[model samples]
Target: MPPSLRVSQRRLRPGSRVAIVSPSFGAPGLFPHVHDLAMQRLQSELQLIPVEYSTTRQVGATPRERAADLNAAFSDASIEAIMATIGGDDQITVLPFLDSDMIAKNPKPFFGYSDNTNLLNYLWNLGISSYHGGSTMAHVARPGGLHPLSTSSLCAALFSGGDFELYPVSEFSEDEQNWNDAAWSDPNGPPPSPLQTSAGWHWHQPDRVITGPSWGGNLEILDWNLAANRWIRNNPADYSGCVLLLETSEEMPSAAYVFRTLRNAGERGLLAQFPAVLIARPKASNIEIQPTPEQRMQYRQEQREAILKAFAYYNPDTMIVFDVDFGHTDPQWILPYGGMITVNGPQRQIIAHFG
Candidate 1:
């Protein structure tokens, strides 16, 4: 695909109906209180009506139902765009059921991340562009309150056009603030935490400005794609000049595991194709294993070394930026898959130029 192919942005007028579907897992009605609040915010704040599907709130529905809902949303002239409720495991199952022709004929903005990586890649393969950030149940329907940064980024993604610059949001929260909690409906929560000072974009080869159509998603999920051979190009050279964006999920795999995955990419001759890679901030905390501040910092450092080692062995010229606020983090920035991204390594600046 050409790095400069422009996907026309949809102008969302007031009362525009946006279909809400669960292509992965269903958690919206499970936490109806929070889901309803998010719906209200979308209608009132953004002036977009939320259109729900039958299986959208039903957990354990067949992948066919999920795929059907996706087709229905795209086919309906009344529905202008599609947004996922949240990400879940096993979205790969829905792949076989999707109609690529239908999606191609009715290309509209599709948004989600994590497991939704499967669908996003599928859309890209069909020559349609999709956004990789924010979900209804997870980001918009947080228990305590919606993050202002999340709302702002999502709005721009849904309604805006032209060149937009993304910066790190000042405050971020990754804790699981429950929508089921009674106190959450209070419309207020604790004050936003202060954002820590960031060590800005880091560069590897500082001589060039690489521009390409963006690709990639949650690192672990891409592993699953490798096994399934769903949307990946058979030849690594086909990905040449593309900016690769990656992130780790809350699963928090060990640094060794991360290295092994990178090694697999190298073995497949996939590492040398991209001129630049944007690493999303790893989600370090989980209910199963909560590490101390010192341990968390060590984890990030070790992961960084692993990435550097793999790059050195395979693609020494690839530029890298660590800990970008995307993927499984609060105040996540929206990224366009198969859209133009410019990485100026010498100046240490990264800019995503979307349609």
Candidate 2:
């Protein structure tokens, strides 16, 4: 488990062919208009020819059907990269059908996050490095257009091949666009969630620099992995030097739930492995569960406090970074799974090695 193996090449030229799959939730299948526009942007904006497999747009496809598409994408010599359309809950179910040897042999770049965390972790154990962000539905097909921050971060990961700094942006989105309505494409979708005044990244126990390959994702998904006893290493030593990247999604689990999830990991002796942790800003409100501004602020504050309490009881010395805009938040940064991250506490800088 977690062996030291050479990673695949990251030097993909513009116009290189890429494959898009729906290994998780098939937003492309549900919203073909959004999917088509995203493909068009991949070609026109990124100058990449985006190809789809059989299950890419098939909403009713089974887990095996989706896994087949993933296998085909990775095995295809014509495809330089593979990306997920959106994320859903059942990616872990698709994992059993995955051909690890086939994926390890092919070793192409895979991009996604959220429930895609399942696949990312699977790839990690196989010695495959992947991009932790850049889902086609979320960033590429965003309402106003592809975000400059996302596009830039993705390009650095795709081409530059090493050592990229992920800077915090001044503005971020707290609301999501209504895909059911045509307004996202009609150029009138609430002006991209209104640019809120950003307060920047919050630091905890920032007394020393910690640099290492990154691991972990949507905390709930990791909890699912732990429960399933799949992909994760049996021994805790495998994660000894990795930085933990944890975040919650739109599901907005309560602060207590977040604490308990980590507490469970701590109980397993897994939380103490990392010298540092990066927690994304908690997405407090969803369309179904709308919270007032005050409530939203309180939700995040409580979640942050919960994490600190858990860490204090587990890995109290770990350097904790909070409210990083990487998870179920707007204008997210594309991080690398199993790639290197350098956290300089003295300079207060966080850098990612995309390659």
Clashes of each: 0, 0
Off by over 4 Å in 1: 1-8, 143-145, 169-171, 188-198
RMSD of 1: 2.2
Q: In terms of TM-score, how similar is model 2 to the real structure?
A: 0.97
- The list of candidate 2 runs beyond 4 A from truth reads 187-190
Local distance difference test, each candidate: 0.78, 0.86
The root-mean-square deviation over C-alpha atoms between each candidate and the true structure, in angstroms, is 2.2, 1.4
- TM-scores of the candidates are 0.93, 0.97
Residue range with the least summed lDDT across 10 consecutive positions in model 2: 182-191
In model 1, which range of ten residues has the least summed lDDT? 188-197
What's the residue-level lDDT of 226 in candidate 2? Answer: 90
